[model samples]
Target: MENKQINIGIIGCGRIAQTRHIPEYASNKNANILGYFDFNKQRAEEIAKKYGGKVYESVEAMLADNDIDAVSVCVTNSAHASISIQALNAGKNVLCEKPMATSLEDSEAMVWAAKKNHKLLMIDQNQRFAKTHIRAKELLEKNTIGKALTFKSTFGHGGPETWSVDGGPNTWFFDKNKSKYGAIFDLGVHKIDLVQYLLNSAVNNVSARLTTLDKKDSTGKLIGVDDNAISIYELDNGVIGTVTSSWTYYGEEDNSTIVYGSEGIMKIYDDPTYSIVVIKKNGEKILYDIDQIQTNDNQTKSGVMDEFIDSLIEKRVPKSDAESVINSMRAVFASIESNETGKRVSISGTK
Candidate 1:
């Protein structure tokens, strides 16, 4: 199996798959894209032309193909669980996009399906593979920052209206029924997951305020979803942090995270001038210049798919497995609950 190429069947041909997942997987020599599966045949065909694979008319067609070894489920948040469950039941390894499912129950089911079917289930929390993030985690283990004390992070952008495939308000990202939440769910999940990964802590409690303060459709009516949210979380390791996520930044994307520690401070993706910079308590500063994390807008190898394929070959769990990342998802949902109830909520049960 090491010498033989792994065939991949993709479940979505939209912006994410075409721009990031498909391209990254295509460039991997150990993998072969068997086909792309999308409800829209024309859209699938368009991607197939550029990515060198057939257009699958339906998901069943892709799953039935004996040549396909794994599937990448990149559909909307609502569809992630069902599609991934089907793929796992069909005996295919799954690489799902982040916020694995819209709810914790669905997330757990995806994990259970993978375990029950004996297939790999990895969530695409790609920030873990980001160069600076990995470096931060390594330094933290080495106690460079001397025990992360508190964190303040923000992830905001103009909006997803201009970020999706067609770039409009009608994208599933803005639909509450489809997406479940707005900025917090769409953009916040990544950062929340990053906090957990970098600091090696679990968010045990949350108090939040999620609102659709400024989002409206063409007719200027409330969208019934949160466009912005501010949350305070208590990690199991006694680290308290604030997370602000919004679709209303109205500027260049802001994906900044600052971790304050006993000895020094570590900032990731925050500085406009540098990728990473650390300032010690005694006024000594050190800057670690590094490349920005890859995204759909930026066409580069995200290193996620490459590592996922390597995990399959090595028969080991991927860096971002479903079971482990569920804690991050729990924190996200807990934030929503706290926002609704105006009280702190506890999220228990995490590995």
Candidate 2:
């Protein structure tokens, strides 16, 4: 018998869906967008009309659909747990956006729901799917950079107020309650998860300094959320890493990673279409242009969406499963704890 395409429901009709997730999933042959739901009914209707899908009046209605095999949650940070839990309890798989939840308790509940329902629960840590980061992971595994010694990775841009096409100062990103953290939560989660993925190692301890540098919101009013952050981490392998994330950087796109090891050095950057440059101890340098390496432009596709589709069709597990993302969340929570206590917090010994 031929396999039927898996039907998916989108829980949020926000920027992420319109920009990345929606386009990627719509292009995949193995997946079909069954419907979409948003708190703003108009937005959901608009996306559904434009994309040729149905609109559900509520998440409950979407969850009750027998055709919907999975739900991609693009909701704000605060709603991740509740929406995901409902979807899972309704016997549907989940593809949730990053920073999993606002607090460890919420994140734990989401994971519990997935496990209880025996459905796939994936976190959209798309940075792991980036061509640059993938190449770096391969090089690390190959020891092309030797035994990893220390690492530094960063992702930053001007505040999100100007990032969206609408240019509203009222983005969910500016809401500390909705976003959970600041730039660190919005952008830092990607790099932090990437560090864990590339090294395949756990972070043991972290000391963080979080600050709200640009106190003004999009409307130029004082905002309480942090705008800049610096965090130092000790990896389980004894390698140390320092991550600096900010929404106030005025220069170029600051997403890069530097890896130093006993045998060589490796660097990945995106100034151009993602590339990896490696320097060996023997004084030879190898440059990999990821765009050229990734035939069929696989690098440009939505890795999370593609993987989710593959997992559905192949009946296999995606590497970026809920448990793995939860580990990254542990680090994020640790940083917040450290920031509040003004001392280093150790994740290794925590529950």
Error of 2 at 254 (Å): 1.0
For candidate 1, write residues 1-351 as lDDT tens digits: 577888999998887887778988988999899999887788888888877889877898899898899999988888999999999999999999977998889999999999999999999998888888888888778877788899998888778888777567677787878888888888889888989888888899999988887777766787778899888989889999998998988857788889999999988887766788888889788888887866435656678899889999988999999988899889999998898788999988855
* Tens-digit per-residue lDDT, 47-159, candidate 2: 88888889998999999899899999998888889899999999999999987898888888888898888898999988788767777898899898889999898877777
RMSD of 1: 1.3
Best by lDDT: 1
Model 2 accuracy (lDDT, Cα): 0.82
Error of 2 at 231 (Å): 0.6
Each candidate structure's TM-score, on Cα atoms with residue i matched to residue i, is 0.97, 0.93
Instruction: State the displacement of the C-alpha of residue 74, model 1, in Å, after optimal TM-score superposition.
Output: 1.1
Worst 10 residues of 1 by lDDT: 293-302
